[model samples]
Target: MSSTLAGAFGIAALFVAVLALVFAVQALRAQSGTAKAVTELAATPEPQQQAQAQAQPEAKPGTVKSELRRLSRELEEARTELRETLQHLAVVRYDAYGEMSGRLSWSMALLDDNGDGVVLTSINSRNDARSYAKEVKAFESDAKLSPEEEEAIDTLRKEASPTLGNPDHQ
Candidate 1:
């Protein structure tokens, strides 16, 4: 019963707060003309009080087209540079054998904008360690790829640019 009474009081308080807010807004809206004039003046500067804005240099005729052409050229150059860079990389580390500890064996995939690049695998052993490289083209390999190598490729593909070779990869 006490809880129900408290809930009723809480609801009444909320209703009073909402009613007060509505009245406050109405009172502000019903202010005299002088108060609104003062508010407008406070919010905006007078004509003479306006600061002299720094003027941008006027563009010459045909400059818009030329500027657009220049920007397009620069964009193409950036895309070409990105295509040559190794943008996608994934490193997979695992234990080669039950005896092997610390998971030193690793396979890494290094791909460019296109899914064309190399996969490097290092097999570690207590006695001796060896590394191998395989070429990948269009997310595939002409030569057989190990399970680790395939995993490396798949990881890089999923995490790399969704549009692999597109200009918007960046």
Candidate 2:
């Protein structure tokens, strides 16, 4: 009976050892799979970088320098175009006539970086309304500017001054 009990205990110990070995093997395989996935991710490029790489093929050193120069030129051209656009603007509203109280009359100045654009004025009176447009060059107009029109242009210039804290307005 003692020998039989010893034999049963040995079989139970063997079964537990086999179960532990199986679990260890499974854990090692899982760790190896995780390592392989991390390696694959490291080898892949970011989406934006991949797009840029695809758009521009590998080039010689000289070709790469020339591409950079071309890009710089395009950027400068875009900046020049933006400066030429009418981006600076101001409006002055006042009562054109003494009897008028609502201040419906307005003078608007629309200029670019170089102060080349137009000034538009609308005069409202009790009896009638009149509108006019005059071309502006270098913040001056060929036609005589009304006081309100000059005030509008002056407002834009004052706002664009470096002292006012906006150098981009220039």
What are the candidates' C-alpha RMSDs? 15.5, 16.5
| Model 1 RMSD, rounded to 1 decimal | 15.5
Which numbered prediction scores highest in lDDT against the true structure?
A: 2
Cα deviation of 124 in candidate 2 (Å)? 0.8
Q: Which regions of candidate 2 fall more than 4 Å away from where they truly are?
A: 1-70, 163-170
lDDT of 2 by residue, 57-142 (tens): 65455543345435545766787787877888899999999999988999999998777899999999999999999999878899
Error of 1 at 50 (Å): 41
lDDT of candidates 1 onward, in order: 0.77, 0.79
Point out the worst 10-residue segment of candidate 2 by lDDT: 161-170
Where does candidate 1 stray beyond 4 Å? 1-72, 167-170
Q: What is the per-residue lDDT of model 1 for residues 1-170, given as tens digits with 9 covering 90 to 100? A: 99999999999999999999999887777555436544543465433223311233433545443344345457768878888777789999999988989999999999987889999999999999999999999778888988999999998778655677665555
